[model samples]
Target: MDRGRMELYNLTLPVGEKHHTLAFLGFLAGDGAPAQAIELQARYISRLITGKVAPPTQKAIKHNLETIKNFSIVRKGKFTYKVPLLKLCDLIACEIGVYPWFWRVFLRDPVLAFMVWYGPIFTAQYRLLGPDSDWDRARAACYRAYDVISANGSQRDKVKVKRDDVTVARRRQVLLFTCGISAMFALGYLGKSRNLHGAIAQWY
Candidate 1:
């Protein structure tokens, strides 16, 4: 989950990609900056997002921020623009795939497993199970499942040995499912007594 969070942060327009200087600057402007500089920054960001603005010029960035601050659109207290928590969460959710690890654990549980195999199979679907759905939600869900799965000593040892492999498989399965590929086939032939092709077709 931490890895996923880092990936999301690393993909953010401002901090991750160097090409979005104007958009980054515009986003900063939206957090309550003055008029003239905000307009300039917005134009710069529009050009940037639209590919009208070329790669950032250090002089331009420095000048724009400086000019904006001088005009009282922004200030240089910590030399950082703090994004609002809700917006930050939305960005993280979109970038890293919301609730990846949590979905893994949810899919692993017998009762919740059906939710993954069949959409909304559970009764209480909308209820929040942990903290708001983000990286923290994923971690908390995983730990909760780990506690249940590892309650037995033997099971706990198995988890210790296969933890890394399991994590990788979970992430892989999620990516595949998101792309519209079902894992039912990979689970192998359930039976040929029934038309296997029909069963697989139903999943799709």
Candidate 2:
């Protein structure tokens, strides 16, 4: 923990492209942690800054983050923070090309491809809808996650949109249709007929 915390202030340490990666882990592990999630980030961003995290310089900390990937997440008392697994870092970086070092590993397998395409289907679903949420909330979170993936997939925009839009659009449609069908399988898992009106409103 000391090493992880110290590397942030050690300017001698090279902060690389993966700099914003830690901020993501802190947010994920912060769930249900006693301290507000922002607090976890403040402490993290104190040494490292990335993404939408505040009070950070535009200075890159990716190398700084790399210094500590070997350290496991430490949970003390009510605090929870982590240096994301190197593999996780690779997945996050693959789209943006944060670290080219890990690309070969990512392309090595189809399953890894899935993680690249869609992360946890409902990262915030249970929290937002309770542990046993109904299909409606499940689908809501699924859609939200799918939207995130689809948006990021298009971030590169190397190909002209006129050419890529149709392709990306097809992928989006397939993903969303898959999401709804997956949701259907869980029908009545939380009581299917609870309220169609509410579900329909969210379908968009």
Best by lDDT: 2
**Where does the lowest 10-residue lDDT sum fall in candidate 2?**
124-133
Q: Which segments of candidate 2 are over 4 A away from where they belong?
A: 1-117, 120-122, 125-131, 152-159, 163-169, 172-204
Q: For residues 23-102, what per-residue lDDT tens digits would candidate 2 score against the true structure?
A: 33233331233233333224334433434323324343453344333333443432223433333333332222222221
**Which segments of model 1 are wrong by more than 4 Å?**
1-17, 21-43, 73-204
The local lDDT score (0 to 100) that residue 28 gets in candidate 1 is 40
Question: What TM value does model 2 have?
Answer: 0.25
Cα lDDT of all candidates, in order? 0.38, 0.39
Q: TM-score, each model?
A: 0.21, 0.25
lDDT of 1 at 92: 30
lDDT of 2 at 145: 67
Q: Write the per-residue lDDT of candidate 1 for residues 1-204, one digit (tens) a residue.
A: 232222112122343356454233333422432332333334334544666535545664454434333333233343344333223332333222332233454444432343323431111221123222343444445445444544643544453555654675686576656543344554355454567677646553
lDDT for model 2 = 0.39
Root-mean-square deviation of candidate 2: 16.2
- The total of clashing pairs for model 1 equals 3
